[model samples]
Target chain A: MRLAAIALFALAIISALGACSKPPASERFLQDPQALKRGKGLFIGTCGAYCHSTRKDNRDAPYLFDCEWRHGGSDTEIFNTISTGVSNTRMVGFAGKLPDGEDDIWKIVAFLRASREPCG
Target chain B: MEATVETAVDMGSELALPEIPTHWTNARPIGHSRGPVADADLRAGPSAGQWLLYGGNYENYRLSPLETLNPATAPTLQVAWAFPTGTSGQFEVSPVVYDGIMYASSSYNRLFALDARTGELYWRYDHALPGDLRLCCGPMNRGVGIHGDTVLMATLDAHLLALNRLSGEILWDAEIADYQAGFSATSAPFILKNMAIIGIAGGEYGVRGFFDAYDVATGKRLWRHYTVPAAGEPGVETWAGTSYENSGAPAWTSGAYDAESDTLFWTTGNPSPDWNGDDRAGDNLYSNSLLALDPQTGERKWHFQFTPHDVWDYDGNTQVFLVDIEHEGQPVKAIVQANRNGFFYILDRNTGAFLRATPYVEQLNWASIDATGRPVVNPSAVPLEEPEFRVCPGNMGGMNGAWSGALDPELGLAFIPAIESCQHLQKGISVYADGQPFLGGTPLITDAEEDTAYGHISAIDVATGEVRWRYRDHDPLGAGTLAAVGGIVISGTQDGHAIALNSATGELLWKFRVGGGVRSQPIAFELDGTAYVAIGAGNWTSMAAYQGGTTNIPEGGNLFVFKLPAGS
Candidate 1:
């Protein structure tokens, strides 16, 4: 009986760890304040202010907050689109090229999502 | 003769009474009845008149009636006035001019009314767009439609808006498609009779494409026809599964209207999950096909599939030209298209029967013709679950970019701007989860240069389906073809020049430097027996991502209206 009880405890712990690894429904990784702050810094450094800045005359590329993803929405979808890139469009993939790889793309996506979210 | 004098006096009084420069410009209805002589014989040539319709006319001919300007003398044509758009977005629209006024739409849904003769702004209307509307294509408005006293326009957020021509007031507005599934409107609306027809854009963004018709006066939805077949539709069997419901078959360009036959001829884009045909198979009905529909009832008359189960994104969204041509000694009503898949198709407009299909460009590898007009696509050419496959025409194709061809009535030729290039495309399987699909592809680009014969303006005989003549350009021909009255075939090139060529022989007539590349179609208009040609010049190219280079052209957006000095 004790052995079975220990086995059940182990299984529950493993399942709990798995659940923790996945992002919660309420807590979007993209809306995390730290991730957005880091993302904004990286975006400014890499993409440069010419395209990422919010300006009236800057019609070439949309502002980071206002960038219309031709693909889909959601943090994961935006992250994947930014990482994988689109063909025949201006969005080029940064999969292996970005400094921090997938994590960096996720950060950028988080920053964009946070920026677009209405603040109280 | 008495009637002509009275008409002239009426026209003069009409022009004199309209001191409201802007109101006079936008108020000119679709088919302006009274104006300076617009006939081919009465003017210097057909290049001497104003462009009044979406594709210049309901026929989608892109031909003008005034002809005073020739390419040989284009350098001598003086600029009367220039109206700067002053906005920063790419303007992909062809301005509609009637009487002495011009109507145009900008990228971000800004419509402007300007004086055609003096380049003065009359009125501006802004359709307030939602914040989160994602645009698959760029924020581009193709053009606008004018019917009766109302000017019609389709917005990027999938709304059809009607404005009072004289007052720029929103008469009626109707939302055609939802923005959540990535559906939007970029193509210009076509006005026929009292019905306004429009097609949805968003094939790349994975939206089920459709075309809708609305009542011109009241914004009542008349009919909605799905480009992809639904469950019980005739072509539902082709999809073979539920995948058909989510298929992508956008009609991103304006359709041609045959007033005589009362048929609307339009083309559709490729099916979605763009690169892979795994889920949706069996010739994916209605997508990448030319459809002829009854404009009033929205019923399909006939359809001709160009690229069945299209995997290379070769959309049949080119302008469908309705022409009356003699095929094998019989007077046949036909529709001509310079398909994006590198083929020229001539179909019987009355029926969707294929008359002839010939390759208009050089590098085409997807399929070849047998005894019949059907394209036997090589199974190996189909994009597989791998990384790199060499594909001809790439995504651009021989006649890629945006161009509208002109059909010369007298010469029986269809003037086209064609590119000669190939691409290496790689496709991989992807899942459609969270509205995004995984696409893995690489393109090996070559052969696009100034010295190489990469692009040309060719005139093809519509009846014989043969290349009559071609004029090579240093850069790709970006603008559309315009056949004018004085035997002049006018076209714009990426090298920033508005060129006039002989419609019969493709001889260079005149060339005028427009300061920037002329990607928009050129229009010719006449006022008081004097002829003028107008073209919008700006340094913008849709294929900017494929080719990386600094644009040498000036970065200014302006409408240049040119005319011969006084009495010449």
Candidate 2:
């Protein structure tokens, strides 16, 4: 019984250290290249094709590449906005719509951030 | 013929009228006593120097009988007058001319009554739109329909409004559908008998597409024909699960009517969740197809699917042209259409029998239609989630239904405004919301340069589906064509030029820089013994998206009227 408790303690310590070392969900997608590529595919296929545009003078929907953020600029805020869409507008929430669920959305956000220039 | 409104009230002496401009000296009197336009007049096509029907006639020929400005005299034509609508964005409205007045609708449902002879605006009516209204495309009102003294207009907020012809006052308004649910009307209402028929647009938003007929006397709906069938319906078996509820088959363009056969032929757009067809399997009926129905009862007579299980957003809503062609050595009534799927199709108008379909555009790699007119899609063209596949004609299509075609029944030629391009289609994921875009994939433009995308006006032989002649251009042709008598076919370009081509041969006759992209249909009419041609000049969202590099073409709405300068 004492030996089992020691093993449990060691496992808990290892898990804690791993959790502390891991990045946030918002930032984790940015670090991975495959995630960014997948995010780009999703971004180009979904957002760029239909509503939002890459051009600065997109008249139908909001332009994403620009610095002006209509909803929120933070990664979490963008994720939330994407997951639960803005009301009284054409932008609908895409929570369970994506194939990879939240991971796909995080990758999309990471792709968007990578494409965007740093805000002053 | 010019006259003044001399009104004497309680005063003994006659009141003086306003001084008329010198240009109005030779103009005809506004609101002459020619009687109200009857139902028979609408079916008679353009006559007596008047244009009452939206398609110029029920056959959607868009041809004018005026021969004053032929190919020989077209070069001498000068701008008679220009009326600026003062609105931004593309102006695609073809003004309805009758008696001596012209009725035109601009973007955002703004209608105007102008003196056909002079560029004087009698009145203008600006429609009140909702604040939170959702729209799939840009806010555009194609044109208006005229029945008696009431002018009919379909708005972007999903409402059909009746306005008084003289005063531009609102007569009555009827809700088409809920705008919040992504239902909107952009096509000009077609006046048939005593009913005004109009189609709804919202395939991008996954709304169940429908075409409706409203009583002209009262704003009550006569009947509604849903493009996508409901559960237990005859065509519902084509869809999987309950996907037919929001499966799009939007009849978003004007239809052609045959008085003899008593049939109304309308075309439908792409199915919803356009890219990935995994959710809804089987041949999605009615979507990307042509539907023939009873005009009065709205009962489906027959339907012909142009693209079965269409994953390529190829809308079959091009302008329907009713033509009588010699088929198999017999004169047969045929319905011809330059479809967005890069094919020029001919079908029996009496029966929904497919005669032939030939490729009208250069780049068509997705499928080849079979003997029964069903497309044999290439397996590689099927959209997948990860790897992108190349498909010709793209989403905008080889020929967009937005820009209409002109059919010259006399010459047996149909002038099609065609775009040649291919797109890399990649399947994406989509979710259905009340008013959200339901696109399940993205069609990425392959390349703007390297001649991958361009526009041309192809003169197609109606019977054989052969390309008689083609007038090529750098930019995609966005304007509708107007075929006038004297062997002249008039069309506009994206780079701000109104051009005239010989109908028999594709020879350029006259070209005028309109100072803006001419994206509207041209109408020809005669007033005071002079034939005049008019077109709307502007640019829109799709033109900007398709155009590459730098463009100097300005964007502004203006109605330009041209005529031969004082008896050539």
Candidate 3:
């Protein structure tokens, strides 16, 4: 029992040494270029041009760059808005329609987060 | 004919009939002779000081006969009065004035009757909108149709209500379609002798489109003709598999009714999913086409398709103007329209035969017109599943059907309020459901900054489809036009101005900033020997959202009526 506890303690210390090492599986999708491309296609197809658009600021829908959220701009909040639509607007929730169901929303959030980079 | 009132107090004439006490209560009722004008009277065009038809006589000639406010004196015109509606919703009201009163409608299905001379409120009716109802487009109510003592209104929840002209009470409410299944109504119903007809909206939500005719007295739905055929119908083979069930072909705009022949002319919207037609192959018949139908029996007479298998969402649902212009040195009856597929077509109204198709916009590169007036699509401009396709004159069209343009019969010119834009369209897989958005592809739509898109009002000659003159604006012009007497073409601009241009030459004569984008249709009339022009400056439609958003147009909710200041 003591050895098991010592092993867990060592693993915990290793995780603490590099805080980013214990990231969620969904968080890693932000760096994967292929995953970002797929997420972009999904966003452009499903959400773009309905109310919001991907091009510059020529649409009635507020531009979705640089993190200005009408509800909340956090990663989790975006996931929620994408998973469950924003009320009183044309935005509809995408639950089963996405390629990977609910998991695709996390990829979209990551893709949008990375889009803020200069020429991502 | 001008309005007469007790203005100067009649001090000298004791022979003027003495006022009888309590006389109004016992006044004899005037028979139907002098009641609200009939549809036949409207078809003949309203006299000066009267606006009978929605588009000024079924020709869709939004022109007026009054010319009291001339171009030379228009600069001295000032605001006669300003009427305000409390709601800030979308205002597409093209008001009708008759019997010394003007009628208009606003968003959320509200109607207003105002005194034409003083702009005073007469009556207002608010349709009780249901909470569960949802609209795919912006909430807008085009102007109402008035016939006899009844005013016909098509509601946002897909119901047609006939109300009394004097009071604000509903006479009857006819449910046209089910709102739960993504069906709504926005356009004004065309009022006839004993029946009122209207079309269906929500084409983006996969609603199978149709238009129904209701009995004027009891509000009973007489007949409904579907724009898309059923599985076993004649046009079902055009749609593969079960795609015909959800194929979008909404007839959502006001139609022109020819009372003499009892034939009706209208247009249809795009097919679903909007940007992707891979699932449903073949030419989707009747969707992007001009259809002629019999209003009495609801039978299809004939149809002329503008865009066969329209994957670009260019709806051919604009106004069908019946023009009696020369064709091959012979006077022929023609139906002219600026099609959303980037071609201006003049077709034979009687047989639906194509006469001519000309390009009105400069950046239209998607298709070319053949000798038979059919569009020859370019393969390179067609969108694909992966790579983005750049198409000129995007899905918003070189011109939209939101407010049909005006026609000048004397000048033989059709003023087209046009836009210049391009889009990057891409196709993808779309899921179909009962009451959900069904656009199956992605599109980046805009008046593209890279191409420097702008707006223009081009006057196209009706005989030949050639643009005679062009009036250019900095922003894209998207409102309706009014061609009146004295060689003036009055039109609203994206910069919130009601401008009057010389009809023969494209000279800017008079302009006034109404403090908001004037996307509403303009109308002119005469009252007390003075001519006045009125326009509602509020546009929350897609064009306004696209142009007004970028132009920083102020929020607008007022209706302005202008005339020559006291003594010009």
Candidate that would win on lDDT: 2
TM-scores of the candidates in the order shown: 0.76, 0.88, 0.87
- What's the TM-score of candidate 1 when only chain A is evaluated? 0.61
Q: Which candidate number would show the highest TM-score if scored against the true structure?
A: 2
Question: Taking the tens digit of each residue's C-alpha lDDT, what string does model 2 give over B216-298?
Answer: 88989999999988888898999989889879888789998988989998899999878877788978999988889999899
Model 3, A1-120: lDDT tens digits are 999999999999888978745554347788888777767656655555555656565445557765567878777778778777766565667667565776677777777888864532
The second chain of candidate 3 has a TM-score of: 0.91
Ranking by lDDT: 2, 3, 1
Error of 3 at B478 (Å): 1.1
For residues B1-568, write the lDDT of model 1, one tens digit per residue: 0010101223456456533222122343433444332222211222344565768777777777655555544546777887776554345667776556677876667787776777767777756666556564356676787766677899888899998765576799899877645678877787776778899977765577899889888989999888988788888888857878778888878887776787888789878756667777788889988888888798999999988887777888888888889987899988888888888888889888788888877677888865556678866666643324456665666675366788877788889887665554444333333233222222333343222436788888887668888898756566777777567887776666777788888888777777666666777778777777777766453343232212455555666777877764
Q: How far is B253's C-alpha from truth in model 1 (Å)?
A: 1.1
Instruction: For model 2, give the interface RMSD.
Output: 4.0
DockQ, all models? 0.05, 0.19, 0.18
Candidate 2 Cα outliers beyond 4 Å, as residue runs: A1-25, A28-46, A54-72, A80-107, A114-120, B1-30, B386-388, B449-451, B547-552
**What are the clashing pairs of model 3?**
none
Q: Candidate 2 or 3, higher lDDT?
A: 2
In model 3, which regions exceed 4 Å deviation? A1-39, A56-58, A73-76, A96-120, B1-34, B128-137, B385-389, B449-451, B545-550, B565-568
The per-residue C-alpha lDDT of model 3 at residue B566 equals: 63
Pairs with steric clashes in candidate 2: none
